[model samples]
Target: MSLRRLLAPLCAGTLLLTTACSEGGEVAPAPRADPPAASDPGEGAAEILADMSLEEKVGQLFVPTLTGTTPEESAEVISAYHPGGFIYFPDNLQDTEQIVALSNGLQDRAVDDSGVPMFLGIDQEQGMVSRLPVGERFPDAMAVGATRDPDAATSLASVTAAELSALGINLDYAPVADVNINADNPVIGIRSFGSDPALVSELMTAEADAFEAGGVVPVAKHFPGHGDTDVDSHTGLPVIDKTRAEWEEVDLPPFVAAVESDIDMIMIAHVFMPELDDSGEPATLSPGIVTGILREELGYDGVVSTDALNMEGVRQTHDDGEIAVMAVLAGADQLLMPPDLATAHAAVVSAVEEGRITEERLDESVLRVLRLKLRRGLFDAAPVDPGEAAEVVGSAEHKDAAQQVADSSVTLLRNEGGVLPLREGASVRVVGSGSEEIGAELEGMGFTLAASAADADVAVVGTNGARGDAEQKGLVTQAQDAGVPVVVVAQGNPYDISELPGLDGYLATYSSVDVSRAAAARVIAGEVNPSGRLPVDIPGTDLAFGDGLTY
Candidate 1:
C-alpha cells in the first residue's frame, strides 16, 4: 500500500481516539482488523516488540548517559548496559562530524547486537540549557513567552527540530511545560514559558505540535508541574505546598494539555509535593504521584520519563542501584542518566527476575519505547548522512527563523519619558556579557558605539545572571549616576530590571545568546518595533504580566 493509504486510516483512528479520551475517560477497545501487512510500520513495531528477548526488552527501558564520544570508546559501556537510548551533553558533542559519526556507530552497533535502534536524546532547550556547542539558538523560554505568539513558538521549534534531527538526535527534551509562577524559582525561572497556566499551555502545546511536524519527539518536562517551587531539583528536593485543587488549577493544566495532545513523553520532576505524596519521596520515586495520579487520574498513557536520576534531589534518598527499580515501579518508562549505570541496570534486572517488578509492567514500558522509536523513523533509518549534519546546523534559514523569534520576543518593560527608539545615527554605549554582539548589531543598524558613557546619546547597559543582582545593581547605580539617560537591557531575567531603581528605559531579551542580543539591539536602535510583552513581572515595579510598550 502507498504511504498515504496506510496513514489515512490510522490518522482518523488516532483523532477519534484522542477526542474520545478528551471527552470522557478511556475509550473501549476497538474491533480488531485482519492481520496487518509487512508494509505497515505500526504493525512492524508491534511485531518487533513481541519478538524481543528478555535481555533486549530490558535494555529497551534503560537510557544511560555515556561518558565517551567515539563508538569505540563507548562500545564497552553500550555493550554492557545495552541501553535503549543515550542522552548526549556538551561533553559528548565535539563537532558536527564527530557527533554524527558517534550516533551512526552507536546505532549500527545496537542493531548488530540486538536488532534494535537506539534513541539518541538531547536537552536542546536552546537558551539556558543548550547541549550542542553550535546550533541555531533561540531566546529562552520566558523570552518566547514574552512574544505571546504561538507562531514564534512553533517557528523556534521547527528550526530546533531540523537541526537536532540532522545531528542524528531523535528525541528533544524540550518545550518545558512548567509555568514559572514563582519568580524566586532558582532553576526553572526563565526556563518555563512564563507564569500563566493558560499562556504556558498554549505555547508549550504549540511547541510540541511544531516538533512533531518538524520530525522529532517533544518530551514535556517536570510533569505535575515544577513552576511554583523555590528550590532546584538538581541540588535538593523542592517541596510544593499547593493542595490538589491548586495543582490542577495551576501546574497540572499544561501536562494535561500535552498528554491530551498526544505528546510523546512526560518527564517526572524530582520535587517533593506533600499534598501529592506524603511519603517524602520526589515524584520520580513516588507511585502515588506517578502511577496513581499521572497515570490513572491524568489519563496519560504515553511514556513517563524521569528527570536526570543522578541529580541530588532523588540521589540523596535512594541507593544508587535502587533508584531505577523504584522509578520503574513508580510507573516511569525511561530512566534518564542514572548515576551508577551497571548497578542500576543490574538491580532492575534482578527485580524482574525476583518478581519484585512484574514482567507485564516491564513490557508495557518497553513496547511504548519501541513504538516511539518506530514513530521516529529509527527502524526505517537509523544512520544520518554525515554531510547532512554539516550542511544543516545553523543554516541561513534557521538563523532567519531564530532572528524572527528573538526580534518578536523583545519586551520593553519601562520606557520612561520615551527614552527608546533612539535616532538612526545616534551614538549608543553598549556594555555587558554580549556587549560585542550588541555593539556590532547597533553599529550595523546605523548607530555608533560611544568612546565613553558621557559621549553617548544614550547608555545601553546589558546585565545578566540572576545571582549577580548586586553586580547589576552597581552597574545600574553607576550608569544612573552618569546620568546619560541609562537604558537597561535585561539579557537573562526580566527581574534584573528591579535591581535598578530609576531608569530612563528598560528592555528584556531574556537571554544573552547571539540572536537574542541582536534583537535587543535592534529594538533599541529603532530597527525593529518592540512588540513583546512581559512573560514575567519585574518585582517592585508597575510592570506585570501582559505589560509591554510599543513605539
Candidate 2:
C-alpha cells in the first residue's frame, strides 16, 4: 500500500480537547503513586503471584526485542522466552497496519497463554531515537526545550501517548531527562531538554506527568547521568569522573523530579561512574548505583530499566546471561532490549530456581511490572483494533499540535545580522544534503528555487549541527563565497554553525522531523513567527542559552 494510504489512518488527525484524556484536555494530572512497597501489589496481587510460575515470572522482567511485525512471525521467540513485553525496533516495523496488527496479535497470544498482558514499548522520544515511526512528527526534546514552555513538552507527550495507546504501545522510553552538560556528549544532546538542571527537571516533570495523564507510561532515562560523557556508549563505556557533590547538583535533579512525579520507569545508562562504584562496573550492572542509590537512597519504588542490553556499552564486558543476572541483582525491575532473548531468559530462570535470585525479589519486579500494566489500563482494554488505529495515530489535531510545537521551537541564532521571513515568492536557492526535500516543500509553497546560487537572490542550506560534517559546511561555505546571503538551517544541534561563522543567518530547528522541517520553512519564509529560544549553547558563538529572535 502507498505510504499516504497507510499513514492516513494512523496519522490522520491531532488530538481533541477532551476532559480526563491523554489527548490535550484540561484534566487534573494523574495521581502520582508513592514509591512502591514490596508487598503492595494491588488487590488480588497475592493470588496473581501465586498463579505465576518461576519462568513466567522471569519473563515479566524482560522486555525483549522482537524481530518481526506479527506475533506469528515472532511466535517462536515469544513462546520460548515469554518476555514481560517487547521493545520494537525499526526492523519490526512495516507500515501502520502491520504494527497495529502486531500489537493486537502479541496481546492476544499473551492473554491466551499466560492470562496477563504484556507491556509493548518503544523509544518514541522523537528525533534521533524514535522507534516505531509514523504519524504526526514531533520536534525532539531540545526543540521542545527551545520553546521554554513545559506545556509544549506536555503536549508532545500527550499526543505521543495517545498515539501509542491507540497502537497498544503502553510504554514509552521517552522524555529523556538527561541534562546536556557536555557539548561533545554524542548520544544525549538533542535528546536532553537543555544544559541547566532546573530547566531539565521542570520540563522532564511536565512531560512525564503529561504522558501519565495521557494514559501512557513515561520512562525517564540514563539515571545518575549520561550527559557529561564525551564517548558514545553504544560502542564503548565512558567513565564519568564527577564528584558525588557535583553529580547531586547537576545530574540528579531531573531523575529526582521524575521519581517524585511518579514516572513509570527510569532507564539506566551503561556509563561507568568512578565515584559511585570503584569496581569499574557500568551503572547497568552496578548494585551500588541501582539498588543502593536508586532503590534505597532515592526511594524510587518504580520500575528500573536498562538501556538496550545489546548495545556494546554493556555487552562487550559480559555475556547476555550474565548481564541479565547482574541487572536483576542490581534491582532493575525490567530488562529492556536484551540481545540474546533465549540466553537471558534461561539465565534468569536458572538464577531463580537455584535461589541465586529469591522468589520475593522476583515478585517485587513482577508485581511492579503488572502494576504498571494496570496503570496503563491494558487489562480492561481490548487489543488495539487495527481499523480504528488510524483515526488516533495521525489525527489532524496531532499533526497541528506537533507543528505548533515545532514552530515554537525554531530558534533564530543569528538572524538579526541578515533578514528572515523571506518573502514567499523570493528566488531561494537551497543547496545542501537533504535540501531537495526542503526545496520541493518550499517550491510547493510558491517559493521559486533558483537554478544556481548565482541566479538566486538568497541561498538556504539545511544540515545537522551534531554531525559537524565537512560536506554540509562546505555547501554553505560555497554559497557564502558566491556573494549570496547564506541562511544555514541547523537541523540537529545548533553547534555545527560554529564551523561556518560568516553566515548571514542561522536557524536551529533541533531536528529533521517533518514538523521541524516545515516549521523551519515557515519561519524562514515569514509564514510563521519563530518563537523557539535556544535550549543549548552554541559553542563558538555569542548566542547564549535561551536566546531567540522573532519578527
TM-score of each: 0.91, 0.90
Please report the candidate that would top TM-score against the real structure: 1
Task: Give the Å error, residue 333, model 1.
Answer: 0.6
Q: Which one wins on lDDT?
A: 1
lDDT of 1 by residue, 1-551 (tens): 21112333342244211111223455544211122335664566676666566666777888888777788877877666678899998888898888888888887677555556778899998898898986788889988899889998999898899888888888899889998888788898889889888999999999999898877889999987888888898899898998889888889889889978989998999999998899989999999999999889878888889999999999887797788999999999999988888888889889999999999999888878877776766765636777988889989988998899999999987887888889767898887668899999888878888987888888888888634567767766766677689998888778876657778998888887899999988888888999999987667777799998999
Q: Kindly report which residue stretches of model 2 are placed more than 4 angstroms away from their true locations once superposed.
A: 1-41, 423-425
Candidate 2 lDDT, 112-175, residue by residue in tens: 5565677888889987777866767788899988988988989999999888888878889888
- All models: lDDT? 0.82, 0.81
What is the number of backbone collisions in each predicted candidate, taken in the order shown? 0, 20
